[model samples]
Target: MAEEKQTCYEGSSVQSFQFYLEHSGEHKAILQCVHNLLPGEFKRVAEGKSSLDVLGVGSGGGEVDAQMLTLLQSTVPAVPITADIVEGSSALTDNFKALVAKTTNLQKIPFAWHIMHSEDYEKHVKAKGVKKFDFIHMIQMIYYVDDLAESIKFHHSLLKKNGRLMIIIETAHGGWDTLWKTYKKDLCVHAITEYRSSAEVISCLKSQGLKYEEHVITNAFDISECFNPSSQTGQRLLNFMTAKDNFYQSFTSETRAGILDLLKNKCSTQRDGGVFFNSNLSCILVHA
Candidate 1:
């Protein structure tokens, strides 16, 4: 893995994500998945617990955080929650705050925002001698971390008795995985380069002798545009998928063509007269 200075979230990465969300219907898929998991997981953790302390890593937009908090509230209606959200992007943090400000439901829950990455949060807690958390969540944001195992360990250590650490990531053998693996091999070196899935994280947990449960969240995207060589949105979608800026111009004609063929043939399937790429993601609930 070569050292990467820039990430998809840095510049064009944000635009790429937004583009994918608009075109692919992944936003709905994500929310549906989160909604699906909340009831069981929240009930399991909130049982016999009167109050909750939560630490959220990579809590982008805070929409998902709000949802989980709401569910937790419903599970233990009398229990109050104190949430600390970790987000590195100031723009995203502000966006989350704005969303929270607008939502009446989220206003009732107490939130303390930490404008930093997971590692920074670890250090901050250690420095302040912070207590353990009852529930922790890392949503769609682990690709930005340096070491998945170490990060998981750090967050797990912050859990209190009967606490749960929930992690959500794309599956290893999905279209997203294929695109990212190809991108790193051919295009650029991103520091946090590994495109990990729930399977991989499960393996990590098993190796540590930790108990965990896995849930599958299936979704797909219409990547038919990538077949078109001249579509700007297609190229930007490629950039988003690969986390490379101007991906069309970054590679040679031969490489670009090869990448497109890989995405079309290997990553996607022909269905309903469109190319649908199934993104198999998973949510893991861990308890020490």
Candidate 2:
């Protein structure tokens, strides 16, 4: 068996991760994209099913998962739902469960938690001979998979007839795309780069002749804190984005300054008198 690789999100301190989200504005951007995509407007092809089976890959804290499920319920009010969540973090899994317990709308919805990475989820489900799902969602988490083609194939295979697989990833020219690509080539050999951008994923889908639709969501994060070299919060943001501990201190001063300058000039834009790291989020819906 191959050794499991540790992800930046899984290895970092929870507080640092939370702080990165807050400072980077990814939390709201993610929710906004989910809200835009999960409306009752989806074609009711799976209309008459008695129960809906939803698989949430890398569901994180479950806040977004619950929101999506609530929207799904509105579309098909009478169908019972079974949400099977897969996340690698125990803390995030617990947080998701707590969210389910407290939210009235989610309280009535059935849920199962799988505290494992996406690949592990596949292995466990295959061993148990689990059936397919009516809906499977992978939101902003595909960048961590080692093989994007294999992962997409597996996720698509797990969808029942007329089932939908929804994926959210950054655009080809987005800040994250540039930063991750640079870091992958220069620093981290094990870094995940397959399907890192919407363009890449779309290319894969086109080559495979998969029927899919893509939507774009515009979002930005405040990178003003990163202007100060001595700022602790700024360092944390850098560390999280690069998936490196002590990013500023890890590299030579010249290299560190060059990277920081690149981030400031190339990765960010000055908007409304604020330094915003512009992001282009692509929502790809694939029908089986």
lDDT of 2 by residue, 1-288 (tens): 766556545545556777776776666776786676666333354566778889999888887788888888777777788888988788888888998888898988878788777888878877887868988989878887777887888899998877889998888888877776665555554445442789878887887788999888778788887778788877888777766677777778877877777787888898787688867688899888
lDDT of 1 by residue, 170-260 (tens): 8878887787777666643663556676767887798888888888788888888877878887877787776667877778988888888
What do the candidate models score in CA lDDT, each in turn?
0.77, 0.77
Candidate 2 wrongly placed segments (more than 4 Å): 1-5, 41-45, 187-195
What is the lDDT for 34 in model 2?
A: 68
TM-score between model 2 and native: 0.91
lDDT of 2: 0.77
